[model samples]
Target: MRVGLFIPCYINAVFPQVGIASNKLLKSLGVDVDYPEDQTCCGQPMGNAGFENEAVSLAKRFDEKFKDYDYIVGPSASCVVFVRDNYGRLRIQPNHQCVSEGKIYEICEFIHDVVKPTHLKAKFPHKVSLQNSCHGVRLLHLSSCSEQNVPYFNKMRDLLTMVEGCEVAEPERPDECCGFGGMFSIEEKAVSVQMAHDKVQRHLATGAEYITGADSSCLMSQNGIIASEKLPLKTIHIVEILAAGL
Candidate 1:
């Protein structure tokens, strides 16, 4: 199946390696993946910032860009889930069919559910605390939500386990939000900072050398705190870890 890679704006500007690793990982799995050069923001920022109308054109543009692909996969769960769940409400084109609505998926979700690879060539010898970004856990169901009584399953954790020498650990609060809710952090600065502080301390408590997750957005925010406090931790996207040594 043909796949289109959707790199979120923040990841493109900041953690470009994550996008590169995502492409490399998918290609190594023998998937036909292509990057749409003209693609831009998925409008998740504007939509989450209380400006849904501004995201309409972006939603339409995203739909047009990847409509032909069998699946549109991105590294960020929040952006993918936004398109999957909110595009229908954007009223773009025919309004009857949002081509990308059902096809878009977070990279980890696509790999775990669709590619179903049993092993990877990746090997990273380090302990990493898995950061279950809210969107990935709650919206995309990338992992079992702590608040729910579902059978425990963590797609990210499973993927990381494939990397030889890599040890995956979870913070005390496995699925807590890192307070990087797109615009939620900007609007609720105080609350967001406190939440991030709490989240980071828990990850540190796990004695992990690195904090890894499917969403780079959350990592970016936590990295800010780590940098400011000079904490003994680093943030790496799960794709980068899964693509290690490859």
Candidate 2:
């Protein structure tokens, strides 16, 4: 199947390597992937900022850009969740709703649910703690969250272990929010810092050398605290780890 890679605006400007690695990882898995040059922000920022009307054109533009592809995959679960949750509310566009639905997937979700690769050639040997982004766990239903009584299953954790020598650890609170709710962090800096501080400390408690997660947005926020506190921890995007293994 043909796939279109949707890189979030911040990731494109800041963590371009995540996008590059995502492309490489998908390609190594024998999937046909393309970067739609016309793609822009998924409008998640604006929509989350209480400006749903302003994100309409972006939603429409997004639909226009990836509508023809068999699948649209992005490295971010939050942005993908935004599209799935908010894109349909903008009635200015037709029900070109696949952009808002199953046709789009977070990278790990696609890898586990669609590609279904039983084996991989990736290997990264390190003790890593998983920071499950809220959108990935709560919104996209990527795995069995700590709050849910479902059977133990983590599509992302399972996929990350394919890297030889890589050990995935769990934080004290498995599925807590990173507090980078787009505008929420800015508007609630005090609460955000406290939440992030607690999360980082718990990850550190796991004796993990690196903190990894599916969403780079969360990594970016937590890494800020990691750097400011002079901690020995480092943040890694899952795609980067996956790409390294390949």
Candidate 3:
């Protein structure tokens, strides 16, 4: 099946390698992948900033961009979830179905659920703490929420397990927010930094050399703290980790 690679604006600008790795990983799995170069933001930033009207045009543009693909996959869970949840509200088209009845999926979800590869050629010989971002855990159901008394299942961990020499661990509070709530980080700078600091400490306590997750925004938040304080930790996208040694 054909898959459209949807790279979010932040990822495209700040972390281009994640996009590259995602493409390579998908290709290595023998999946036909195409990246629409003209793609812009999924309008998540605008919608999260209390300026949703400004995001309507972007939603329309995004929907038009990848409408024909069999599946739209992206590395960021938040962006993918935003498109899935809000596209109907934007109603760019007449009686629009949001993301065409959820045609879009986070890369890990797509790989784990749809591609269902029994093996991978990737090799990352490092211990990594998995960051279950809010959108990934609560909304996308990538993993079981901690508050719920349900059987535990982690799609990110399941995918990473296929990689050789990769040790995946989780923080004590696995699904806590990293405080990069788009505009919330800026509006509540002090609170955001505090939350990030706490999150970083918890991640480090796992004795992982790197923090990896499906969402770069959370890793970006913790990376800021790790960098400023010179912590012996690094942030790498889960896509990068999975694409390693390919």
Off by over 4 Å in 2: 95-100
List, residue by residue over 140-182, the lDDT tens digit for candidate 1.
Answer: 9999997888899999999998999999899997998999887
Q: What TM-score would candidate 2 get against the native?
A: 0.96
TM-scores of the candidates are 0.98, 0.96, 0.97
For candidate 2, write residues 49-144 as lDDT tens digits. 888888888888898899879999999998888887777777646754445465889999999999998877777888899988888898898877
Candidate 3 regions exceeding 4 Å error are 98-101
Query: In model 2, how large is the Cα lDDT of residue 5?
Result: 94
| 1-246: candidate 3 lDDT, tens digit per residue | 999999998899999999999999999999999998799998988898888999989998998889899999999999998899988887777664755437999999999999999999999999999999999999999999989999999999999999999998999988989898888899999999999999999999999999999888888998999999999999999999889988
The better-scoring model by lDDT among 2 and 3 is 3
* Highest lDDT model number: 1
lDDT of 3: 0.91
How far residue 150's Cα lies from its native spot in candidate 2, in Å, is: 1.7
